[model samples]
Target chain A: MTAEYFMVLGLLGVAFFSVAGALLGYEKSISGFGVVVVATVTALGGGTLRDILLDKPIFWIATPEYLYSTYAAIIATIFFVRYLPHVNNYYFLLVDAIGMALFNIMGIEKALISGTGMVIAITMGITTGIFGGLIRDVICREVPSVMRNEPYASACLAGGLVYAALFTIEVDYIWCILGSLFTTVFLRLGSLHWGWHLTIFRKKDFKNQSD
Target chain B: MTAEYFMVLGLLGVAFFSVAGALLGYEKSISGFGVVVVATVTALGGGTLRDILLDKPIFWIATPEYLYSTYAAIIATIFFVRYLPHVNNYYFLLVDAIGMALFNIMGIEKALISGTGMVIAITMGITTGIFGGLIRDVICREVPSVMRNEPYASACLAGGLVYAALFTIEVDYIWCILGSLFTTVFLRLGSLHWGWHLTIFRKKDFKNQSD
Candidate 1:
């Protein structure tokens, strides 16, 4: 029953991820098949990448239900966008943060179970959280917002650290999961809400004579 | 002995891939440690991704020599670019094509050995050939050249088909490898030399009022 519940939750999160990705594609003037492609990648790309990097069986391949949710979400999003032409970036950020938070904890748990070190586990967690958006932005030909915009990966990193700390102290695994998820969601949403930004390295930022 | 020889060849190809990736990062004004990261990804990302999708051990993780060559190439290219200010797009295209051609065959061979279908094998071949540069371009905030600039993946597709046809017809594996490599390199180089391009979809291309 728990497994089934998590599966449903995972599929729902994938749907949100698909919609966020579709919105990005819509903004880029990508139409029809392109939006589907973007949405599919956005929803499945992160766990796929994480699984690949960890040399584990791909999640969506093992359970094809995720693909169904992704497709269904894209179709629904397209219709919703047609009626609501003003669908904006804020909506994208909101859903994206939720998905990222969910994936962050999932990644941390997976990495830990895989026997990776804390640092690598944290990195994997962040990779899971942001790679979907990173791939989305990359295909859309924009500097990955993870690198330039607010602290997306940083939020994941912070959450992963919290989870690790809790685990190290012999806390219940369930509490550790909740703590990490709460931390990730809080930081991610806080950044969006307060318009927090991280400074990126720019050519002008360096005053080297060689440059 | 034959496996050792192939290992050396793969590492050499990785070096070239690293240099091409570093040159791209240089062109984009990404300096220092960032170039190393980009070059490493360009050199290892394709094979790593292919292995991951195939649920196999990552090639670079299994063989650290590739990473050494990638780092060595990045350092060499940093020096090469410092003295050569006029390193242009043509140089990038040349090395990139060579590396892509090498990876195309490697991907096809791996996929066939993994017992994937011909079409999926060909798709994997194209993915290996172009994904490194695609990732590089994405990280640099450019539309992937593979998608827009020319017939990059198409060349890999042609080569992969040649390999599949030859294998199906009971051609010697050596001949099949050579045929595929030659076709991919020839088409890729030919496209570069002749300034060939594939037209991409644009807003103006479709006259639909719904658009």
Candidate 2:
């Protein structure tokens, strides 16, 4: 698909994941007010950070559509939560993955367009991919997966590196997007199944620490 | 006090608050990782949001002193948390007040300098004052006081309106800042003492069901 197509899809993914996050928070017994807070963060957190770093008007404030979509998502989650059961968990993962991939692609493109070097571009890509989820977790009072043993950030890193490498080789734009998405999806799924993670610290290191 | 004095004091206040936040977060019963996260947020959160909204280089990154001060604060907190029990709560109120006053004044000034009209300037000032705390509360998994019944945003609104009025009347910049700070501090203190709040919702309002 073209870049523009992916960007629109990404925005939709953000809306979907936001609702999913709210549903999950509701199931976890988070307060109604807390659910709205988490939903807003899950939807707009990444884009807000990206716009701030780029020194641009916030995307949502500039265009009302994002805000409207987020509001709709929140309302939908609040009203429809009781009807759904195990479906939310599966939907959360799917929407999260889509949002992650879309954000990574858009972030890389924006950084490149701003004339950033490969290192900064990749960093921004990874940041955009995971920042919304990080904000969601932080707001839910859970340790952000990125700061823990999860391969969440690692998958973004791999996708970003792939995008950068492909761009360097002057690969076709469509192929680059596909390649990056494939890399992220594979890494994430494999990690989930095989329990893959970065070796940040050994279990022995924290053996003496109280839990 | 002169504008320069206020600026210097504000910076120093930022340093003090950063240290205090880090120390409070590092208490014996607190998780070490959580402490670092909260400390970082409490220290730089307000200024970061202010700079981002103003589209300026982040104040801390532009001047490394902020980072240095935050690190120093963290270290000091770690070593001295046990010695100071009541200090934590008192420090929270004090530093928060100082930060609020300084940031509100600076945000209005910056907006005025950027050629925004009085209304926009007032809005920006109020936003700058509260955005950081909103972020912090969200991260702490609490409903943001601004979104709830707290008079936090209302106090900002009052202060900003007073500042705008003074500026429109061609008052001295010093008087304007003092007037705004006074209005904010008293209103905020009064709110806390009286438990004043603005209820955005009424129980009867929800009876309409999607009107």
Score every model by TM-score: 0.60, 0.58
Tens-digit per-residue lDDT, B78-173, candidate 2:
667668666655566556665666677767776677566665566567656766666666756555555444556667778888988887798877
Model 1 per-residue lDDT tens digits across residues B114-160: 89998888889888888888777768777787656677888888899
lDDT by residue (A44-74, candidate 1, tens digit) is: 8888888878778888888888877788899
Off by over 4 Å in 2: A1-3, A6-10, A85-88, A165-171, A198-211, B1-44, B56-130, B134-211
Top TM-score model: 1
Those runs of model 1 whose alpha carbons end farther than 4 Å from true positions after fitting are A1-9, A25-37, A51-87, A111-127, A138-143, A146-150, A153-165, A186-202, A205-208, B1-23, B29-40, B52-55, B60-130, B138-211
lDDT of 2 at B39: 68
> By summed lDDT, which 10 consecutive residues of candidate 1 chain A come out lowest?
A200-209
Candidate 2 TM-score over all chains jointly: 0.58
In candidate 1, chain A reaches a TM of 0.87
The DockQ score of candidate 1 comes to 0.13
lDDT tens string, model 2, A1-211? Answer: 4656755755775786687677656545553344555676677778778877876776665555666688688878676655443344666666677678778877787788778888898888888888888877765667777877767878888999998888889988888888988898788767777888779668876886745
lDDT of 1: 0.77
Shift in Å, residue B101, candidate 2: 12
